[model samples]
Target: MRISMWVVATFLLAAVSLEAQARALTQNQQSVCRWGSDIAAGAQASKLSGVSLYGARKKLQVRKFPRPWMRMTALGITEQTYNSASRLKPAAVKQTYYEQCVRHELARR
Candidate 1:
């Protein structure tokens, strides 16, 4: 009985691990993740160019360069811009955005 229980537990654990590994982002999810990364980069660019967060947002809107996910990411970056301390780095922000977008996409699926 003990051996059988151990075998079943191992099998269930392996199945769960395989299912997680098998999951991959779809094209749409990839696009959203890319957009999120882009938004974060854009924030860094705006900072480097001496543009305010509001100005950067306006430029993006005028160019119509971002999707909904990008807009959301940008908004978060903009909020960070106002805070003098604890300002998020562009790469860190990008990673966060990408993860969130991927998770949201996965949940939708």
Candidate 2:
């Protein structure tokens, strides 16, 4: 059970790595970007503990996040960002996402 959970977590991280950069995303998109990157970081941390991201893709499991639907949207964003910049490392990708997310959040304040 624990192993599966870890696998799911790692898979989630794997999917979440790589965010959009170079081009700007709308505020709404940035919101999702932040969330997905955050989730990816958590997932990466979980992997360091030997967790895998194999089983966490299901909606029921995704409810661990505040908004399950949003998480699904995050997956889409993560995938798109990752594909757009496959050459970049995950850490760099997360940093870019973080910067954009922070900027978007700060503007609202």
Candidate 3:
């Protein structure tokens, strides 16, 4: 009985893990994620380049990134994330963006 219970538990865990891993971002989603992610990354990284958060957003708008202002609104990066992570090194910022974008997209499904 103990062995059977353990096996069942293990099987259930495996199934749930596989299901979570199975959902993938579509091609368009990959593109959109990259677009938004890069924009956010550039904005955040700009602090090192001497740009303020507000300045970065305006520059992005003048350069025509979709919803530059709204990226901090609901359904996107929180202001806390934008503010706190402003000084992350470029590589770390990129990984952070990729993970956040992936998690958000997956949860939307």
Candidate 4:
């Protein structure tokens, strides 16, 4: 009886933890999506001004937005990084990678 109770308690705890993790992951994903969108917008603006990916990355560094935002922005600066890894390769490949990375981060969240 005691063993059965322990097992039940453990299962409940595990279930609760899983729920918390899922919620946290959702929040992280949303945050990433927002940040990625912001970074992409910024990159697009830079591109209009004839800024290269390397230059854009430097510009984003100067802005220093925030975590995930900053990271995503930096990620948006490297065209090669996006081309090598991302399967989708959106027109704005750098920005797409930034967004995908955000999504990936969320999935792991």
Candidate 5:
């Protein structure tokens, strides 16, 4: 019974970790979509983490507008951005581009 409990706890921890990672990735995706080159450039120049920037944006969003539906809008924007940019290559490539772009932007700052 102890072993079973341990296994269950381990599984729960893994699930939670995966969920948090997914949330972070989704937030980054939304930020990339909404601000695109601008945010990426800023992040790169400022030497800031993309996830941190996204968190700041989220805080600003809640302070200015308390609508929960904004999350849906972010999702929609990410989808559109992905669809439009993925025409020439895979989505992963575009994601990498944005990540690198952020780094470049941060470097400048």
Candidate 6:
């Protein structure tokens, strides 16, 4: 009986640990998605205002860029201007934007 109780206790602890890990992973993924979306929007917006990526980065700061996801979309529409001017690929730029957004959001929290 004692052996059975010990096994059950161990199983419960393992299950709890697994649950915690899963929750943490889910939160991390959600954060990444949110950040990427924000960066893309910001990039698009900057493009619309005739701001080069370098100029925007300098002016807004990567973390302070506004409506990042929307900006990214705008860039997508005007690929020639941004693509020719920026050193980064669109996806890479978007990821960097997202990372910055995530950091800023976390700092705010």
How many clashes show up per model? Answer: 0, 13, 0, 0, 8, 16
Q: Which stretches of candidate 4 lie over 4 Å from their true place?
A: 1-25, 77-109
lDDT of 2 by residue, 1-62 (tens): 99999999997775454233313456766666566676555444433444434432342254
Clashes in predicted model 1: 0
Which candidate tops TM-score?
Answer: 3
What is the Cα-based lDDT of residue 64 in candidate 4? 52
Cand. 4 Cα-lDDT:
0.56
Clashing pairs in 1: none
lDDT of 3 by residue, 1-109 (tens): 9999999999899757644543477877676666666655665567667776566666644553455554444223423445673567766676567667767878898
Point to the candidate with the largest lDDT: 1
Ranking of all candidate structures by their TM-score, best first: 3, 1, 4, 2, 6, 5
Residue-wise lDDT of candidate 1 within 1-109, one digit each (tens)? 9999999999899767544633577666687677767766667656766788678777766665434555555677655643434356677666666666666777776
After the best TM-score superposition of candidate 4, give how far the Cα of residue 12 lies from its true spot, in angstroms. Answer: 40
Better of 2 and 6 by lDDT: 6
For model 4 the TM-score comes to: 0.41
The TM-scores of all predictions, comma-separated, are: 0.54, 0.41, 0.58, 0.41, 0.26, 0.35
Candidate 3 — which pairs collide?
none
The parts of candidate 3 lying over 4 Å away from their true place are 1-23, 66-82
Clash tally for model 2:
13
User: RMSD for each model, in Å, please?
Assistant: 9.0, 14.5, 8.2, 12.3, 15.4, 13.7
- Model 6 residue runs over 4 Å out of place are 1-25, 60-81, 84-109
lDDT of 4 by residue, 1-109 (tens): 9999999999899767644544556575656655555555555555555676777676556665556546654564444442343333234654454446554665663
Of 1 and 2, the candidate ahead on TM-score is 1
The candidate, 2 or 6, that scores higher on TM-score is 2
- Clashes counted in candidate 4 amount to 0
Considering lDDT, which of the candidate structures 2 and 5 is the better prediction for this target? 2
lDDT to native, each model: 0.65, 0.55, 0.61, 0.56, 0.46, 0.55
